[model samples]
Target: LHTGCIPPIVHRDIKTTNILLDQNFQAKLADFGLSRSFPTGNETHVSTVVAGTPGYLDPEYYRTNWLTEKSDIYSFGIVLLEIITNQPIIQQSREKPHIVEWVSFMIRKGDIRNIMDPNLHQNYDIGSVWKATEIAMSCVSPSSIGRPNMSRVANDLKECLISENSRTGESRDMESKSMEFSMGIYTEVIPKAR
Candidate 1:
Protein backbone atom coordinates (compact mmCIF):
# COMPACT_ATOMS: atom_id res chain seq x y z
CA LEU A 1 0.00 0.00 0.00
CA HIS A 2 2.78 2.47 0.86
CA THR A 3 4.56 1.62 -2.38
CA GLY A 4 2.10 0.48 -5.04
CA CYS A 5 -0.38 3.28 -5.35
CA ILE A 6 0.45 6.58 -7.00
CA PRO A 7 -0.80 9.52 -4.93
CA PRO A 8 -1.65 6.68 -2.54
CA ILE A 9 -5.25 5.51 -2.26
CA VAL A 10 -7.21 5.11 0.91
CA HIS A 11 -9.08 1.81 1.26
CA ARG A 12 -11.96 3.63 2.97
CA ASP A 13 -12.96 0.26 4.35
CA ILE A 14 -9.97 -1.36 6.02
CA LYS A 15 -10.84 -4.25 8.29
CA THR A 16 -9.32 -7.54 9.38
CA THR A 17 -11.47 -9.42 6.87
CA ASN A 18 -10.37 -7.16 4.03
CA ILE A 19 -6.79 -8.29 4.70
CA LEU A 20 -6.25 -11.74 3.18
CA LEU A 21 -3.37 -14.12 3.81
CA ASP A 22 -1.74 -16.07 0.99
CA GLN A 23 -0.64 -19.72 1.31
CA ASN A 24 2.80 -18.42 2.20
CA PHE A 25 1.25 -16.21 4.90
CA GLN A 26 1.87 -12.95 3.06
CA ALA A 27 -0.99 -10.50 3.62
CA LYS A 28 -2.78 -8.64 0.81
CA LEU A 29 -5.34 -5.93 1.19
CA ALA A 30 -8.55 -6.55 -0.79
CA ASP A 31 -11.96 -5.02 -1.49
CA PHE A 32 -11.36 -1.65 -3.09
CA GLY A 33 -14.92 -0.70 -4.03
CA LEU A 34 -14.95 2.02 -1.42
CA SER A 35 -11.35 3.07 -1.92
CA ARG A 36 -10.65 6.69 -2.80
CA SER A 37 -7.67 8.45 -4.33
CA PHE A 38 -5.87 10.83 -1.99
CA PRO A 39 -6.20 14.49 -2.80
CA THR A 40 -3.77 15.84 -5.36
CA GLY A 41 -1.42 18.84 -4.91
CA ASN A 42 -2.49 21.43 -2.33
CA GLU A 43 -5.55 19.34 -1.44
CA THR A 44 -5.54 17.79 2.00
CA HIS A 45 -8.65 15.77 2.65
CA VAL A 46 -11.61 15.09 0.44
CA SER A 47 -14.87 16.18 1.96
CA THR A 48 -16.93 13.07 1.40
CA VAL A 49 -19.69 11.31 3.27
CA VAL A 50 -18.23 9.00 5.90
CA ALA A 51 -17.67 5.49 4.54
CA GLY A 52 -16.12 2.63 6.50
CA THR A 53 -16.78 -0.32 8.78
CA PRO A 54 -18.27 0.30 12.22
CA GLY A 55 -15.59 -0.86 14.66
CA TYR A 56 -12.76 0.48 12.50
CA LEU A 57 -14.08 3.86 11.47
CA ASP A 58 -12.08 7.01 12.40
CA PRO A 59 -14.16 9.07 14.77
CA GLU A 60 -12.87 12.33 13.31
CA TYR A 61 -14.15 11.39 9.89
CA TYR A 62 -17.48 10.41 11.40
CA ARG A 63 -17.82 13.80 13.04
CA THR A 64 -16.55 16.53 10.70
CA ASN A 65 -16.46 14.46 7.51
CA TRP A 66 -12.98 15.82 6.65
CA LEU A 67 -11.16 12.81 5.30
CA THR A 68 -7.38 12.88 5.76
CA GLU A 69 -4.60 10.32 5.62
CA LYS A 70 -4.80 10.42 9.39
CA SER A 71 -8.20 8.73 9.16
CA ASP A 72 -6.54 5.59 7.81
CA ILE A 73 -3.87 5.95 10.50
CA TYR A 74 -6.60 5.72 13.13
CA SER A 75 -8.07 2.54 11.64
CA PHE A 76 -4.58 1.04 11.35
CA GLY A 77 -4.15 1.69 15.06
CA ILE A 78 -7.08 -0.64 15.68
CA VAL A 79 -5.55 -3.27 13.38
CA LEU A 80 -2.33 -3.03 15.39
CA LEU A 81 -4.29 -3.70 18.60
CA GLU A 82 -5.94 -6.71 16.97
CA ILE A 83 -2.51 -8.05 16.05
CA ILE A 84 -1.37 -7.82 19.67
CA THR A 85 -4.41 -9.02 21.63
CA ASN A 86 -6.19 -11.15 19.03
CA GLN A 87 -9.34 -9.59 20.38
CA PRO A 88 -12.38 -8.45 18.45
CA ILE A 89 -12.59 -4.76 17.61
CA ILE A 90 -15.80 -4.37 19.53
CA GLN A 91 -15.95 -6.13 22.85
CA GLN A 92 -19.72 -6.24 23.24
CA SER A 93 -19.89 -7.80 26.71
CA ARG A 94 -17.40 -5.45 28.35
CA GLU A 95 -18.22 -1.98 29.67
CA LYS A 96 -15.64 -0.55 27.30
CA PRO A 97 -16.74 -2.39 24.19
CA HIS A 98 -14.26 -0.88 21.78
CA ILE A 99 -10.83 -2.46 21.69
CA VAL A 100 -9.16 0.98 21.43
CA GLU A 101 -10.89 2.14 24.56
CA TRP A 102 -9.96 -0.99 26.47
CA VAL A 103 -6.33 -0.85 25.35
CA SER A 104 -6.04 2.84 26.14
CA PHE A 105 -7.45 2.27 29.57
CA MET A 106 -4.97 -0.51 30.24
CA ILE A 107 -2.05 1.53 28.94
CA ARG A 108 -2.95 4.59 31.00
CA LYS A 109 -2.82 2.45 34.12
CA GLY A 110 0.56 0.88 33.09
CA ASP A 111 -1.00 -2.58 33.12
CA ILE A 112 0.05 -3.67 29.66
CA ARG A 113 0.26 -7.31 30.73
CA ASN A 114 -3.47 -7.33 31.31
CA ILE A 115 -4.08 -6.11 27.76
CA MET A 116 -2.13 -8.95 26.17
CA ASP A 117 -3.64 -12.14 24.85
CA PRO A 118 -3.10 -14.90 27.39
CA ASN A 119 -2.45 -17.35 24.56
CA LEU A 120 0.84 -15.58 23.83
CA HIS A 121 2.23 -16.67 27.18
CA GLN A 122 5.84 -15.41 27.50
CA ASN A 123 6.87 -16.23 23.95
CA TYR A 124 7.13 -12.60 22.90
CA ASP A 125 9.64 -9.89 23.75
CA ILE A 126 7.90 -7.68 26.25
CA GLY A 127 9.92 -4.64 25.21
CA SER A 128 8.93 -4.97 21.57
CA VAL A 129 5.34 -5.54 22.52
CA TRP A 130 5.29 -2.43 24.66
CA LYS A 131 6.86 -0.33 21.90
CA ALA A 132 4.21 -1.48 19.45
CA THR A 133 1.43 -0.84 21.93
CA GLU A 134 2.68 2.68 22.48
CA ILE A 135 2.72 3.33 18.74
CA ALA A 136 -0.83 2.03 18.40
CA MET A 137 -1.97 4.38 21.15
CA SER A 138 -0.37 7.37 19.44
CA CYS A 139 -2.11 6.46 16.22
CA VAL A 140 -5.55 6.57 17.83
CA SER A 141 -5.23 9.89 19.60
CA PRO A 142 -8.63 11.67 19.45
CA SER A 143 -7.28 14.54 17.37
CA SER A 144 -6.59 13.37 13.83
CA ILE A 145 -3.57 15.69 13.61
CA GLY A 146 -2.15 13.90 16.61
CA ARG A 147 -1.63 10.60 14.77
CA PRO A 148 1.63 9.61 13.15
CA ASN A 149 1.82 9.03 9.39
CA MET A 150 1.83 5.50 7.97
CA SER A 151 5.56 5.66 7.14
CA ARG A 152 6.38 6.34 10.77
CA VAL A 153 4.18 3.46 11.83
CA ALA A 154 5.88 1.09 9.36
CA ASN A 155 9.40 2.08 10.41
CA ASP A 156 8.52 1.69 14.10
CA LEU A 157 7.09 -1.78 13.47
CA LYS A 158 10.30 -2.76 11.69
CA GLU A 159 12.29 -1.56 14.68
CA CYS A 160 10.09 -3.60 16.99
CA LEU A 161 10.69 -6.72 14.87
CA ILE A 162 14.44 -6.12 14.84
CA SER A 163 14.46 -5.56 18.57
CA GLU A 164 12.57 -8.80 19.16
CA ASN A 165 14.95 -10.72 16.91
CA SER A 166 17.92 -9.27 18.83
CA ARG A 167 16.41 -10.29 22.16
CA THR A 168 16.29 -13.88 20.87
CA GLY A 169 20.03 -13.66 19.97
CA GLU A 170 19.26 -14.67 16.38
CA SER A 171 21.81 -13.40 13.87
CA ARG A 172 21.32 -12.83 10.14
CA ASP A 173 24.94 -13.86 9.50
CA MET A 174 24.17 -17.36 10.79
CA GLU A 175 21.26 -17.70 8.42
CA SER A 176 23.39 -16.62 5.45
CA LYS A 177 26.18 -19.02 6.43
CA SER A 178 23.72 -21.91 6.67
CA MET A 179 22.35 -21.19 3.20
CA GLU A 180 25.82 -20.94 1.69
CA PHE A 181 26.97 -24.19 3.40
CA SER A 182 23.89 -26.06 2.11
CA MET A 183 24.51 -24.86 -1.46
CA GLY A 184 28.19 -25.95 -1.25
CA ILE A 185 27.22 -29.50 -0.23
CA TYR A 186 24.55 -29.77 -2.93
CA THR A 187 26.98 -28.65 -5.69
CA GLU A 188 29.69 -31.09 -4.57
CA VAL A 189 27.36 -34.12 -4.80
CA ILE A 190 25.69 -33.17 -8.10
CA PRO A 191 28.92 -32.54 -10.09
CA LYS A 192 28.64 -31.22 -13.69
CA ALA A 193 26.69 -33.05 -16.45
CA ARG A 194 29.05 -31.71 -19.19
Candidate 2:
Protein backbone atom coordinates (compact mmCIF):
# COMPACT_ATOMS: atom_id res chain seq x y z
CA LEU A 1 0.00 0.00 0.00
CA HIS A 2 1.60 3.22 -1.19
CA THR A 3 -0.43 5.55 0.95
CA GLY A 4 0.96 9.05 0.46
CA CYS A 5 -0.64 10.25 3.66
CA ILE A 6 1.86 11.15 6.39
CA PRO A 7 -0.33 11.57 9.43
CA PRO A 8 1.53 13.42 12.19
CA ILE A 9 2.54 10.63 14.59
CA VAL A 10 5.04 11.57 17.28
CA HIS A 11 7.03 8.78 18.92
CA ARG A 12 8.33 11.21 21.62
CA ASP A 13 10.53 8.52 23.15
CA ILE A 14 13.06 6.55 21.07
CA LYS A 15 16.10 4.75 22.41
CA THR A 16 18.16 1.61 21.77
CA THR A 17 16.79 -0.23 24.84
CA ASN A 18 13.26 0.60 23.75
CA ILE A 19 13.91 -1.39 20.53
CA LEU A 20 13.41 -5.16 20.75
CA LEU A 21 14.79 -7.81 18.43
CA ASP A 22 12.67 -10.72 17.30
CA GLN A 23 13.79 -14.34 16.87
CA ASN A 24 14.99 -13.40 13.37
CA PHE A 25 16.80 -10.32 14.70
CA GLN A 26 14.37 -7.83 13.24
CA ALA A 27 14.01 -4.59 15.20
CA LYS A 28 10.63 -3.67 16.67
CA LEU A 29 10.28 -0.23 18.27
CA ALA A 30 8.39 -0.09 21.56
CA ASP A 31 7.52 2.26 24.45
CA PHE A 32 5.36 5.01 23.04
CA GLY A 33 3.85 6.44 26.23
CA LEU A 34 4.63 10.01 25.17
CA SER A 35 3.43 9.45 21.60
CA ARG A 36 0.71 11.70 20.16
CA SER A 37 -0.97 12.65 16.92
CA PHE A 38 -1.59 16.12 15.58
CA PRO A 39 -3.98 16.84 12.74
CA THR A 40 -2.31 17.80 9.48
CA GLY A 41 -2.13 21.53 8.60
CA ASN A 42 -3.09 22.49 12.15
CA GLU A 43 0.31 22.50 13.96
CA THR A 44 3.16 20.14 13.19
CA HIS A 45 5.50 21.39 15.92
CA VAL A 46 4.12 21.94 19.41
CA SER A 47 5.61 24.01 22.23
CA THR A 48 5.33 21.32 24.87
CA VAL A 49 7.32 20.86 28.07
CA VAL A 50 10.61 19.00 27.73
CA ALA A 51 10.20 15.22 27.65
CA GLY A 52 12.18 12.07 26.65
CA THR A 53 15.52 10.54 27.64
CA PRO A 54 18.39 12.99 28.19
CA GLY A 55 20.94 11.75 25.66
CA TYR A 56 18.41 11.10 22.92
CA LEU A 57 16.45 14.30 23.44
CA ASP A 58 16.49 16.81 20.55
CA PRO A 59 18.39 20.00 21.36
CA GLU A 60 15.97 22.02 19.24
CA TYR A 61 13.00 20.69 21.19
CA TYR A 62 14.77 21.38 24.48
CA ARG A 63 15.58 24.95 23.48
CA THR A 64 12.31 26.02 21.83
CA ASN A 65 9.91 23.37 23.21
CA TRP A 66 8.74 22.84 19.63
CA LEU A 67 8.23 19.12 19.05
CA THR A 68 8.06 17.73 15.54
CA GLU A 69 8.93 14.59 13.62
CA LYS A 70 12.62 15.59 13.62
CA SER A 71 12.76 15.09 17.40
CA ASP A 72 12.31 11.35 16.83
CA ILE A 73 15.02 11.44 14.17
CA TYR A 74 17.50 12.83 16.70
CA SER A 75 16.74 10.01 19.13
CA PHE A 76 16.92 7.41 16.40
CA GLY A 77 20.38 8.73 15.44
CA ILE A 78 21.64 8.03 18.97
CA VAL A 79 20.13 4.55 18.74
CA LEU A 80 21.91 4.00 15.42
CA LEU A 81 25.20 5.10 16.97
CA GLU A 82 24.65 2.63 19.81
CA ILE A 83 24.00 -0.18 17.32
CA ILE A 84 27.16 0.62 15.35
CA THR A 85 29.59 1.17 18.27
CA ASN A 86 27.91 -1.16 20.79
CA GLN A 87 28.38 1.65 23.33
CA PRO A 88 25.94 3.21 25.76
CA ILE A 89 24.30 6.50 24.83
CA ILE A 90 25.83 7.99 27.96
CA GLN A 91 29.19 6.67 29.09
CA GLN A 92 31.47 8.00 31.80
CA SER A 93 34.94 8.71 30.52
CA ARG A 94 37.54 10.88 32.32
CA GLU A 95 34.90 13.49 31.57
CA LYS A 96 31.42 12.26 30.82
CA PRO A 97 30.47 12.90 27.17
CA HIS A 98 27.32 11.78 25.44
CA ILE A 99 27.54 9.32 22.55
CA VAL A 100 26.75 12.10 20.09
CA GLU A 101 29.63 14.21 21.36
CA TRP A 102 31.99 11.28 21.34
CA VAL A 103 31.05 10.38 17.78
CA SER A 104 31.32 13.99 16.68
CA PHE A 105 34.76 14.24 18.24
CA MET A 106 35.94 11.09 16.48
CA ILE A 107 34.45 12.27 13.19
CA ARG A 108 36.16 15.63 13.62
CA LYS A 109 39.43 13.79 14.12
CA GLY A 110 38.76 11.86 10.85
CA ASP A 111 38.99 8.50 12.59
CA ILE A 112 35.49 7.03 12.58
CA ARG A 113 36.99 3.53 12.71
CA ASN A 114 38.00 4.26 16.32
CA ILE A 115 34.36 4.45 17.29
CA MET A 116 33.43 1.08 15.71
CA ASP A 117 32.86 -1.95 17.90
CA PRO A 118 36.02 -4.04 18.34
CA ASN A 119 33.89 -7.20 18.64
CA LEU A 120 32.90 -7.06 14.99
CA HIS A 121 36.60 -7.25 14.04
CA GLN A 122 36.99 -7.39 10.24
CA ASN A 123 33.66 -9.15 9.66
CA TYR A 124 31.76 -5.97 8.79
CA ASP A 125 32.40 -4.02 5.57
CA ILE A 126 34.17 -0.70 6.19
CA GLY A 127 32.19 1.09 3.47
CA SER A 128 28.87 0.07 4.98
CA VAL A 129 30.01 1.12 8.43
CA TRP A 130 31.10 4.52 7.15
CA LYS A 131 27.82 5.04 5.29
CA ALA A 132 25.75 4.18 8.38
CA THR A 133 27.90 6.44 10.53
CA GLU A 134 27.36 9.30 8.09
CA ILE A 135 23.61 8.80 8.27
CA ALA A 136 23.72 8.75 12.06
CA MET A 137 25.75 11.96 12.13
CA SER A 138 23.30 13.66 9.80
CA CYS A 139 20.42 12.61 12.03
CA VAL A 140 22.12 14.04 15.12
CA SER A 141 23.09 17.35 13.55
CA PRO A 142 22.53 20.37 15.86
CA SER A 143 20.12 22.04 13.44
CA SER A 144 16.84 20.17 13.10
CA ILE A 145 16.68 21.15 9.43
CA GLY A 146 20.15 19.66 8.87
CA ARG A 147 18.89 16.22 9.89
CA PRO A 148 17.16 14.03 7.35
CA ASN A 149 13.58 12.85 7.72
CA MET A 150 13.01 9.36 9.15
CA SER A 151 11.90 7.97 5.78
CA ARG A 152 15.04 9.34 4.14
CA VAL A 153 17.26 7.79 6.82
CA ALA A 154 15.54 4.43 6.36
CA ASN A 155 16.00 4.61 2.59
CA ASP A 156 19.67 5.56 2.88
CA LEU A 157 20.41 2.63 5.18
CA LYS A 158 18.65 0.25 2.85
CA GLU A 159 20.64 1.55 -0.11
CA CYS A 160 23.94 1.28 1.76
CA LEU A 161 23.23 -2.33 2.70
CA ILE A 162 22.25 -3.14 -0.86
CA SER A 163 25.39 -1.55 -2.28
CA GLU A 164 27.55 -3.49 0.15
CA ASN A 165 25.90 -6.75 -0.91
CA SER A 166 26.48 -5.91 -4.56
CA ARG A 167 30.14 -5.12 -3.93
CA THR A 168 30.63 -8.44 -2.12
CA GLY A 169 29.03 -10.28 -5.03
CA GLU A 170 31.28 -8.52 -7.52
CA SER A 171 34.41 -9.36 -5.52
CA ARG A 172 33.45 -13.02 -5.43
CA ASP A 173 32.90 -13.05 -9.15
CA MET A 174 36.28 -11.41 -9.81
CA GLU A 175 38.09 -13.89 -7.58
CA SER A 176 36.41 -16.82 -9.34
CA LYS A 177 37.34 -15.37 -12.73
CA SER A 178 40.97 -14.89 -11.66
CA MET A 179 41.18 -18.54 -10.45
CA GLU A 180 39.66 -19.82 -13.71
CA PHE A 181 42.04 -17.69 -15.82
CA SER A 182 45.04 -19.04 -13.87
CA MET A 183 43.79 -22.62 -14.44
CA GLY A 184 44.06 -22.20 -18.27
CA ILE A 185 40.35 -21.37 -18.67
CA TYR A 186 39.74 -18.39 -20.98
CA THR A 187 37.71 -15.60 -19.31
CA GLU A 188 35.86 -13.11 -21.48
CA VAL A 189 35.97 -9.46 -20.41
CA ILE A 190 32.57 -7.76 -20.08
CA PRO A 191 32.26 -4.50 -22.09
CA LYS A 192 32.24 -1.39 -19.97
CA ALA A 193 29.34 1.08 -20.26
CA ARG A 194 30.16 4.33 -22.04
Best by lDDT: 1
TM-scores of the candidates are 0.83, 0.79
lDDT, each prediction: 0.78, 0.75
> Number of backbone collisions per candidate, in order?
0, 0
Weakest ten-residue segment in model 1 by summed lDDT: 185-194
Q: What residue pairs clash in candidate 2, if any at all?
A: none
Model 2 agreement with the true structure over 7-101: per-residue lDDT tens digits: 66778889877888888566677987887665678565877888899889999999999988889899999989998888888888714378888
> Residue 72 in candidate 1 has what lDDT?
85
Residue 111, candidate 1: alpha-carbon lDDT: 80
